[model samples]
Target: MRTPAQNAHLALLLEVAGTPKPGNVDRHRDLEDLRFEHFLAGAVGAQRGLEQAANGGAVGPAFERSVEGMAAQGGGNTQFGALLLLVPLVRAAADDLSQPVVEAICEDTTVADAAGFYRAFDHVDVFVGEPPAEMEPLDVRRGSDAVPALEERGLTLLDIMEQSVPGDDVAREWVRGFERSFVAAERLAEADGPLTERAAAVFLSLLAERPDTLVATRSGEAVAQEVTERAAELVERNALETDRKIVERFADELVERGVNPGTTADITAAGLFIALERGAITV
Candidate 1:
């Protein structure tokens, strides 16, 4: 069996190598300073922390450590979203990929995990929305300063996620039994091609399914909705690839428009991780 770190690292590579991921960087695409190499290095750099998570380490600190590894390697937070999904999945797979095992890990999250998550933000830039109105001064964007409030309420990471599910795609995955990740894995299985192409297709499918919360948080709901509609149109007419130029043009437009469907990419990475862990794909 491959180590959890290896699986996660490979999963990130596969997710990044998959080309034409709408609004996101891939092998054939670049985003200013965030190139494909940064992501590749970030994944490999994060392996040790992922191994710790698999070995029953705290998810939050492990996540923090992983993001720190990325920064240490000159990678600017390229794989934070991927790490967030993979750490728990890797930890759960240490027992089995069964839903109960994974759900238990999520439910067992502590305030420290929440703090670790916030600390990760201090190391990298991820556009996030405001904190819950009831939880003043607990903004994730506040970085470590919000930790005291997080601790004062003694809210577990899962508790924090539950509150954000309405607007956070990743949080929805955690609170809802990872429905999207697993479904994307199934979609990956049904699509036959190089593992990279399958991963890319799964990403497009996810973009068709919902507006990316990250995009909505960064841009606005209107832009995200427009992206969703475009993806849906491509998927509905089976024209995502029939006319390669059009698809490429759309990707170029999204990049120019600064609309990143990041949540979809994150979930796509999660799906790739699950597929590997389940032996549906080999490293």
Candidate 2:
């Protein structure tokens, strides 16, 4: 039998799978859409708890520690288990919702499977330009590697939100609206050109609070700038090399603790490699 937490997560997933999609809905269609929406809302609420845990909140420390311990184990680890658990949740949500929008999210997840999570950082490096000439080469490379790892980790965490919460229709509709808004804003930013520094800063400020905004915004330049600034800040405030090593060590420790880490490490490593090969560090 699934534990109470797992049961709760499954319940939330069911809710999101049932919500209504925007624009394409016909009132003539049955109340099944509405019921789905209701379930989706509840699932989203439950997912917040899961996200917090995945992101290193107090509630998820044990799980995080377990992941770390699994990483220590030579081949398998906690991250792999997390992925296995996560894949089913997302897949179920997609299957239940049967909407284009939900399918899009599933598509994105599928792409993630192909590309791995860390690939997004390549866009970030391109946005930020090159580090100062005086900065150590090792530091730059390590920093570059670290950014993608964190991004991949974040995506892994988002899997909980995407899969566990439920309401495919509602979530997809919300995603559509968000995309529309982001596209509009990006257009405005692009037209402004180099004058967009302030706009870029504002965008990043908003992104810090709402990362999802990037999906909707059309201005790759603006998004890139925001990512660059954020990455720089992380480098200045923390040692990228040290942080990367620590994360690796944590995974190692998790393995020693008897948790499976193979999936996370494979995904993370793949992402890092992709970023390194495809990413641009200089503007």
Candidate 3:
């Protein structure tokens, strides 16, 4: 049986290898600034941190290390949100992969974990929304410089995630018990065909279910809703099974618009890890 860390690594690789996830950097598509090879390098570089999480290391340090290693490649930020979701899940998987267990793991995070999370921003340029006026001093974009404020507030990693929920789908998983990730895992497990095909199908389903926060931040709420509606239409038409060219065309249009549903991809990576851990997906 593979370890959780190995499964997490494979999850990252498989997520990228899944073809034509609209506006995502998949095997058949690459954004102007990011490439498939960069994702490969990130997955490789992140092994140490994944291993750390599997070994029951501290969430903050392991996450920081993962981000640092992921940023070792030329790509600015390939999988920050994915790693954010993976770290706690990997830790929980080391014991029990239940919602309560995962919630407890997140709840156990310390102020130091918050510091490590802040430090991670120094390694790469992760796109994030501005903090509220009152919390401007603790803005994540401030990077390690915000650590002191985080310390003064005695904010844990979970606390930071709570604060980020309004603008970040990934962070909402932390606050809301990872409902989407777990649901996607079940969908992936029950789906037919190769893992990549299942991943693509799940990716579309997720995009259809909700507007990607990354899309909203990068484009606008209107654009994000449009992308979600488009995905919903494709899913309704059974395009993944019947007419893949239609999905490909949608992918092409999103790429042209420079709109990336990155948060959906991140959740998919977390779901892949869960499926792998549960033996819902076997290597």
What's the lDDT for all of these models? 0.84, 0.29, 0.94
Winner of 1 and 3 under TM-score: 3
Candidate 1 residue lDDT tens string, 176-282: 88888889887887888789888877898899989999999899899889899998888887665587577778888998888888899999999998888787876
Question: TM-score: which candidate is best?
Answer: 3
**CA shift at 216, candidate 3, in angstroms?**
0.4
Model 1 lDDT, residue 115, Cα = 94
Tens-place lDDT digits, model 2, residues 1-283: 4322333344223212211111111111113223334333333333433343334333223222223322333222113222223322223332331235333434444323322222222222211223345422312224335444434454432342243222221122223422322332333234332312222222222333322222222233454344344434533544233454442343243233332212211222112211121221001
Q: Number of the top candidate by lDDT?
A: 3
Question: TM per model?
Answer: 0.95, 0.19, 0.99
Worst 10 residues of 2 by lDDT: 19-28
Off by more than 4 A, model 3: none
Score candidate 1 by lDDT: 0.84
Better of 1 and 2 by lDDT: 1
Sorted by lDDT (best first), the order is: 3, 1, 2
